[model samples]
Target: MLGPVAAWDPDGTPLPLGAPRHREVLGRLLIARNRVVPVGRLVADLWGDEPPAGAVGAVRTFVSALRRALEPGRPPRQPSRLLVTDGPGYVLRAGREAVDAWRFEDIAARAAGASPHAAVALWDEALARWRGPVLADFPTAAWAGAEQARLEALRLDAVERRADSLLATGASRDAVADLRAHVSAHPGREDGWVLLATALDRSGRRGEALESLRRARAALAEGPGGHGPGPALARVEARILSGTGGSAAEPGGMAGGVWDRAAAAWERSVPARSRARLHATAGLLRDLAVTGAEGLGEAREHRRDLVAAAEATGDTELAARIIGSYDVPAVWTRADDPAGAGELSRAAARAAARLGPGGPPALRARLLSVVAVESRGDAAADAPLPRAADSPAAEPWRLRAERAADEAVRLARRLADPALLAFALNGAFMQSFATCGSAARREVLGAELTRLAVGHQLPGHEVLGRLIRLQACAGLGDLAAADAEAEEVDRLATRDERPLAGVFTSWYRALRTCETDGWAAARPRYDALLATAAGSGMPGLSRGAAALVALVPVMRGDGLPGPGLARLDAGPYRPWLDPLLLAASGDAEGARQALAAAPRPPHDLLQEALWCVLARAAAAVGHEPVLRRARDELAAAVGESAGAGGGLVSFGPVARHVRAAGRALGGP
Candidate 1:
């Protein structure tokens, strides 16, 4: 049950299960963990949306085979005690110790209340039960998805808990290797990053700790939800930068001493029912704090429980905070979950109302900052721009976000708290992105952040500041500064074991070569960058690089292969690249249609390069209207190189594209 579905005899010999279908029956029963699974549910799960005429009969046959294998020695007349008939279905009747997965869960549950040393041993014993992925042999079965995800999450939690125990026992160095592996495999897990950084910092590897935080920020930003470093990472980073060792007292600051002390006091003073509710809320918050994108569904469940528990405690501030703290490090701001963001916004507003004018300024500032951040919902800095008519609807939120950010920064600065100021400044930066022409503003914000971060010795914030500055430099077409910043980023990334750190620098350099030399000369560089992006878990970068690699043949007039064209169709740059590919393939009308339908990418580091590509495509297809549009857009950065702005792929100078579009439109 922990790995591939199978059974073993009393002496550890493997017992042969009949067929795949028979094994699936056992697997389903085992997943129920000794509970009854109805025959109808089993049939529905096995067939999915369409069941055969005799699916119930097939299910019974499989169950019969499973029963035979489980009780080979049972007398013919005696009723089987193991696989007994229950209401509506069959029950496996396996005890906790009979199955590895159930035993593992039991051990984990016990470990929650154990001391550090005992917890370490228990976690080790539980983790040792896993041999591979859950239902390893049924990779594509629809029935396996939920159980696999649940068990895998449990396994991950076990590993993290073990690391926490190691940290608690002052074995920080011992925890680093496993934590590094955990973060590498599960880069999106903010808790993994937090624990890894804490372990590295406690081990006196301060540089690596900062690097881990930086990588965490980048990895989270690249996800579908496009979130920044959430509160958990931010708090851990602040603790590390303040030179607070990851003592057993803090252990990554996951649930700090303050919470523990307060909870203990409440237990002594409050009613038992209230104390129970408090304890439950605390447990839910801990779970929420550690969960990332993969566990968002679970996080939502915890959020609901915490909200209910918070209300039950009748503490207004606690309830507000609990409701506001649904800050899983994913999909918080993305358009896909508007209801979630709206809930958070309402929570923050409620918190603000409760705090009143006399509440702690820091708390108020933090709340304001959260509001500012949330106001940018669906307007992610790198997201594609909406149509012209939709722009007006977005302006009010942007202005409100700006106001909130300004006030938050003012309050933070008035307090002169570095951590609070960093938080405020981050919100300000996130809201700085407009529909277009935001590079200059980001450049200023980035500089201020870098200065503040450097002065306070906040290495994680410093890295983020530098990254923003690097993107701004590229957008502003300052190649020399961009190159220098890229070098620094590469150095920090290499020192800290962040494989994805050097991607930007590598892309920038390759694009430079592609612009100066030719496609043939830069082909190998693009190829290598593509491989690096894929291996570093950067699917976006990989797709961008793949598009560029595929274009090399097209640029040489050799035409793209079918697979290459198919790959091009799926990338973000498909709108621009489609026209170029179609024009090169002798389909002028198709190229024109693609150009007409293409929406402009959001104004960011990559906007100029994409526009330049569109400009070339327009010129190749002799589409004068698109040519004029491209020419006007490129004219803004005529002296700058287009591809250098985006490190992923380059298409030469902005001036060249502008001039080509001008000629196509019968201008200069």
Candidate 2:
């Protein structure tokens, strides 16, 4: 009867209720559940405000008919037991469990406090009993409306609870998908957004977490009062910002102070039993904000407490998450410690598996990329830029990382979330850059993402997208485009107050100056850029600037610097440049050997420049074969003109010089 009325005889044969009206009467009585439903109210519900003059008599006739159907063998004068008439109305005698709605509610109430895994099963069973809304076929019936609303509300609560259980079980990705739908349907619920944001952050999509908070605020803004985001929403934003190394500590200290006060309030106000997760989160944020290992110890202690508390609450999923969070630092920082890195990666993978097969692609991609980076070995101090990508065919781990990044891109695109898309695109682009050397694939992706980010007004994404495009352009030997894009990046960075934007763009400027005006002309700019980068306390950019500084002697055709190759071993470019310096110093044979032993050059503007130098040296040494190969490879990498034109300064002059040398040698 929970879904539709089903009456049967003792022998399991169908027993027809007299008519639709008779069934309606029985449904009303069943819904009443042993309580008196006055005839006056029944008449009004069955017929609305307007009713026939004989409505009461008609209702009585239907009730009598229902009684007869229930007790077919009753004596002529016997009173009914199942459907009995009171002074003003009729009542149906039935236990609460006899009604599916009542039973579902009862079970759901009990399951809320049960172990999460068990509760998930229990809630699924309870929710399964509800085929649809209560009395779904009779939507216009007055008695059904209130009950329908009440039942539906309970259903939503059960869904939310089930999602919470999933999250506690380390099924954050699944939880995120469900909560997205839930919030779309019920945007007024702050808890849904909180859960969604936490799940995103846990899945390693920090940008998505902040975007979720913004969505929440936007939803709430459409509410009656038109107020800004609540304190809870702000807390979630603060946590995300802290996790991502964003500016949580605004100038004048007000914003950071507010976040501190809010964290304190949550700790003090939330029940002690429920505060473990909050404490762990706060501690982690503090650890991220503080330099070195100052806050790490305390953060570790909080994570331990959280794991203990989650296990105590029978939430194995939550315990797994706590452990996963504890391993994040090691995952990013353990490249020098392969044993520890492998152990952490394996542990994270196991935890994700417990969340089931379709775990968060973003999280999986992050872990896989970390493994890829570790496998690539330590960054060459001279190679200022991170290895952009690794070929999937290179090694087993590399394949896994590429596949994971691709999957993340697919998933993020399907989600159509700006922040998530940006995150996924960066992963995909990095893979492309590392393996293929910033080809058309990465250039197109970078341009498309930059446009999308601009359209969406996402400052972070815009900065990233612009930088990606600029880098790709530079790699493609399109310095004119790179210069324009660099300017835009600087403008956007200033607008967004993202100073790191200027660091890379400044390096490009120095590169351009050295290529067109020679190293002597660009030396002061490089020096100033290096100083600025170092002062910014950003080690990567500083390393990049230093790498550029090491190239001054090569650009000026002055051979190696006075300090020699050892001091000039600035990064990835050193191997390619050493040979050119050797040739310049009249060691043509030695230069040829160095070029022969050089690593496969990255397909970039700088590499093209090196190829030009190699070609010139090959021509000078009468190595016609080497000269042809260098010329052909350079043309393939940077277009048919040997990377000339397009206002690009670097390779054009070098390529011309090499070609002039070839002509002088009677070589093509």
Candidate 3:
């Protein structure tokens, strides 16, 4: 029986199935399929080492009930035709087709030899017979285990075969969606992941295909060695990466052994699109292995060669894919090669556009986000030499960046994948933080990003999310909450191999320590973290740490640092730093001028700090206009920084600071 057991009389009308015990007896006999079942075995199968007294009598009574039910009009002396007393027990005379399970098995056996489309339909019909588990009402029955396992295997096989047919029909996107659902429901199925990867690659979502392989490898690693991603999964990853055009080493520095195995497999393979990409990737890796800037230089040359080769072969897809994967020139922000970064950004935008809208939504989202980030960086790099409070060219670029982030989030939400959604949210967070005029808006975005990161188990994202919350708390003057967020950052930072999060956490701790304890007490720790950050290769953190290290004396009402610290770019903090430095030097007019020149970003903790410094300077100099400006800015800043979404974060501290400024300025 495929579901609950039932019976019908010869007249094609339903017959009462009887009670649980009666059904159990009937079910056992039906399973034996007319074979003689011994009375001792039936009793054991029914009770399993706990047979009550009169169990045999109970069996006989159940048999009599089934006999009357199966042959309702039989005469008293006539031998039963359905339930027969065979040997010492009973047998239910039923044909093979009388059992739905038997019918399914027969159809499944014959379906394997049919055409792909026909086979899928037959399998669907076979599977539809199963309403639920075998022996639906008897989960604990010992007799159900082996049969349940067999039927479950058949169901999974049918599902896999259906996916195979869909793939053969060129419905790869449909197959990808179906296989993802199957893999989600049955994570231990290696075949499901392999097929999903293939489908993803075929659909032009190569990045996602590689990500699926990584998931498969992680899953397989839980088993014994050699149990992880097999050759098919590995080949898919190699094929995907061959077009990525990232640094020669695998992203996150996957072990050399993985590439070695794939390379070996490719060597034995004939020339194909994937094989050509693999060869190009190998060339890049060889160049990267040369070491130093010379190696980096050679790697760039190799990438160019690959691009040329792809174009020559008329494989514009591979060319566009490779170009899209190039890193935004990070060094441009160092003022070393801003022009180069601009050129690369423009180049990537052009190449990415060639792929058009047919690419997967997630892939398209990634391309948009990358281009936007690069464009913003290019604008920043080209900003005037003077720390001009504001740049006329920055607004449109920031708008473009925000639009790109919004589009990415829209696309990611459409996909309904937690990882991709978190990624999109993270990008939006960065964009808002970079472009928003109000500090409160950035704080709200950061808080939302943190919640998403924590909920999704995204460790790296959690770090960034918590980092923003920490900064928000510190800005709003909520030391306790900031400290708690700091502790969380410390915890999450250890989960990542990169030192980026740790450096940020350490920097925040030093700033909090400097405020509670004196600068002298915080300096040593700041110095240590700065040293670590300098070697961390994360330019933004390294630069920020160094600037903070240089600002300790200035924050203590001393003069600015000479040479090195003076030359360090303060980034967004420059607007605030200029006024603070002018105030420290006792130049009221200069402080007023600097404050006037400061850019008014929508949200910035440093702006509050600057306003406080200016209010004090204005009080001493008796500049009513300057005092009025500081009081207004601080009041608005306090208002915005009040809540977790960027309202006064450290309400108590911010309130006290604003009140003190108001008092000094002769305000309410």
Which structure among the candidates has the greatest lDDT? 1
Comparing 1 and 2 on lDDT, the stronger one: 1
Clashes of 1: 0
User: lDDT tens string, model 2, 1-668?
Assistant: 35555456668676678777787777777777567899998898789899999999999898888778877888998998878777787788765565677778778865764667898888888888887667766767777777677778788878877776776777677778888998998897666676778778777888888888889889978965565455666766676777642221221122343466457757766776664654467446434422323243344335434445544655545644443333222111113333443443444344555655465554544433333332322221123322211111243444554675566577667655565566556546544534223345656887887887765555556766677667666655676887888888877666445554565677678767866687678778877876665454333224333644554454435233344544543444566566666776788889778766665444333445555656655666666655666655544443322322111224444445445555745776
lDDT by residue (1-668, candidate 3, tens digit) is: 56677677656698887998888787777667567899998999998899999999989998998888878899997999878887888888776566777777767765654556686688778878787766667667787677777777787766766666655555568778878888887776666776777677667787788788888888776745445555555654665677642222222122333465467656666466663664567456443622333444455446555545555655545555554444222211222233543444455455557767777676666656554544533333334332223332345545665777788788877775555666566556545544212455655766776787655455556666676667766665667877787788776545343244555566667766777776778778777875665455444334444554565544344233345554666654465556655565667688768755554433223445445545555555465565666566556555433222221111223455566656766667
Using all chains and alpha carbons, the TM-scores for the candidates as numbered come to 0.47, 0.46, 0.47
After superposition, candidate 1 runs with Cα above 4 Å error: 1-411, 427-441, 475-480, 494-499, 512-521, 538-541, 548-566, 622-625
Q: List per-prediction Cα lDDT, in the order shown.
A: 0.68, 0.59, 0.59
Clashes of 2: 9
Question: Which residue pairs clash within candidate 2?
Answer: 168-317, 168-318, 169-317, 382-570, 382-571, 383-571, 383-572, 388-434, 389-434
Return the TM-score for candidate 3, rounded to 2 decimals.
0.47
